[model samples]
Target: MMRRAAFALLAAALLGPLPALAQDAPLRIEITEGVVRPMPVALRFEDAGGAGELLGDITAVIADDLNGTGLFEMTEPESSPATGFDRTVDYIAWKATGTEALVTGQVALEGDSVMLRFRLFDVFAGQPLGDGMQFVSPREGWRRAAHKIADQIYARITGETPYFDSRIAFIGESGPATERVKRVGVMDYDGAGVKWLTSKDDLVLSPRFSPDGQTVLYTSFASGVPQIMSLDVETVTSTALTRDPRAMSFAPRFSPDGKWIAFSRESSGNTDIWIMEVANPSFAKPITLGPAIDTAPSWSPDGRHIVFESDRSGSSQLYVMRADGSEPTRISFGDGGGSYGEPAWSPRGDRIAFTRQTKAGSSIGVMRPDGSGEQLLSEGGRDSGPSWAPNGRVLIFTRLTADDEVPQLHSVDITGRNMRPVALNDAASDPAWGPLLP
Candidate 1:
């Protein structure tokens, strides 16, 4: 039972108390710029399943995950001589092919279960950095096994926990805006095995997972007006966080420890930031007070401070404050008037990602905690709602087509490479990325 606390000072200062605008217009963003190229690497399938092609499928999946990061350019396995897990003795050979790193592995089929053994080596160092381990799983679960292996390899090489085996909970959309149908959907980090946690008949938004990935908090208009609610992912049972009939609450995010929920609450025409104990929702407290609009509160990794979007400066700007709701500081100073919103603090706690709207268009960008070194990563069309992958090097956000007819979930490397849509069978939006699965 982790105790989660919500920090709401920043939100209260911004948007003074106001009701949500009844605009049917879709949110828009622009990908104004990006980085130049991607990194390169070489990967050879370890002959784990002997000389059979069974191992090829396993290695291919692993390669996909690495390549998908846009941080690695995978070398064709056919061009390499390191065919077996134990036969990978030629470091110079792979180095000659311009590969900075190499991955080799083996797979064994034991009854209905399979064991995969893999190793990640630095081609430049000419040595393995970590011990090779074997993963055992049912034969039907090979795909997930491959993801786990990729995660292990990524962590060993980058010193960051991999997000490959994680899951994303987002709103799946269907029907028209006047009578929209939105359901809470959860899927693997790679966009596979999508399962709807809530029926489409409900108007759900801002689906966020608990730190442990067992529960989700979202805003649902199912009860008529928008209200904050929590759902146990395992049981599919939901409980409303607030019962204010005239008040509309949105943008609920859990504290790092998962003991409290920080969200926006609108009551009697005033919207402010508030926190409630998950163990006792009745224990609600307001962290922000004002006549402005303050929404979208994101907690710092240490739980000492919170970053949220507010219009206190006559425009939406990013702000940070102490968890107890004191000492507020504005963090954004870029082109204003277009409104900056949806500030998501990185799990790494080094930077914050946000959506910036200008007359040119809305763009996804990141800046230091003090609002320095702001860099716009994407442009053209709408690329709003940036959520950090568990590794903190990648972001998942909604990219709307030009006509605004289709909204898809796309991922981009922090360096601005491998910007592509996640493969899902349905339309999605307002994606909230979850932490890596343990």
Candidate 2:
């Protein structure tokens, strides 16, 4: 888990005792299909003490996060009856309005920090969904605290891992198409708190976050050639992981354990998959060597196998092999007459997302590890570079069209519904979703 070393944040029990209730089956919404009716949810957040504008901001973020998922519909807070954090929820009133879940919260401002406490309730069951918890953070970190609250509610209701409190690393592009300037940047998953990690003097591509989310591996042209580099997320410093002058390395990704790095290295004229130890980057070795051009290696969730793009069969396709470069098997058979590349293994270990380019256009699709059950999850115009969320229910990718002709980030559910562009000011590409925060 990734934690903010600079912020003084603490999570503790609520100040007052919470309600105790019946133990019935918890409410859950399994996301298996594309079409889903939004669940009716009522939210009422109170200002505990000295929390004026902060309360509204926090409440808005929580509501937006929940409603944006397309699984939950929030009722107008001003229209709903008021409720206290310590008092019993009005189940009858909420149920009368067809509300299934009710969320109540309180916010207070301390000397230099703010305390946020919240809880969830099953309206029909007349029971508290979970215990109330409080989070204390500096005034500037109120958004982080709000994300935490939203994550808790999401997980408790959906029976899945939360991804609201996560960040994304991407390549920010600007300028004309003939000469564009690119830099590495990081921001909140919803495109807030943008921070640039590199200067625009050199080009950077394929920014991959480490398992711990503290470091980013990317290919840089600072040395006038493509070389793998690692950047510290906190300090904004970078170090070259591969300094070989004879070879060009790119598409770097960390293994599940964070002890090894899988990337593509091209020397002379052939490109192959390579692995290097984080502790000993000076000693790097090739994992796949053949006449075909093999690149863009992605590791399975268990770190036992790797899926990459290869052209050994005379066309670009996806292949899976052991982590040690043995027992190679082709996963994509080109049933659509196009090509595939940039394979990303889902965190759930159930699917592999990839970029499929057919004669019609380009689309983002996914398939089982063995290449069965292939499903295209996007319109075939110009969609590529699919990166799975931490929960594997949604994917973020880049899209381009002739109307705009600029690359931008967009997110879509695995079922190909609710596809929307990410709220970003500049042209962005090569998005990499990090893990949830600690």
User: Each candidate's lDDT (Cα)?
Assistant: 0.82, 0.90
Candidate 1 clash figure, as a count: 24
Best by lDDT: 2
> How high is each candidate's TM-score?
0.86, 0.91
Which digits, one per residue and each the tens of the lDDT, describe model 2 over residues 281-384?
Answer: 98789999988999999999999999999999988999999999999999998564789899999999999999998888899999999999999988658898
What TM value does model 1 have? 0.86
Which candidate number has the best TM-score?
Answer: 2
**1-438: candidate 1 lDDT, tens digit per residue:** 122111223333454433112222347899989955444666556554442565888888788888787666676654665445777558787777777777777787767888888777888889987888888888888888999988887787768778898899988887776776889999988888898988877788999988899999999998898998899888989989888888888899999999988999998888889998999998988898998888899999999889998888898889998887798899998854567889999999988999988887778989988889888889745779999887788899988778746778998877776789898988899898887876
Error of 2 at 221 (Å): 1.0
Number of clashing pairs, model 2? 0
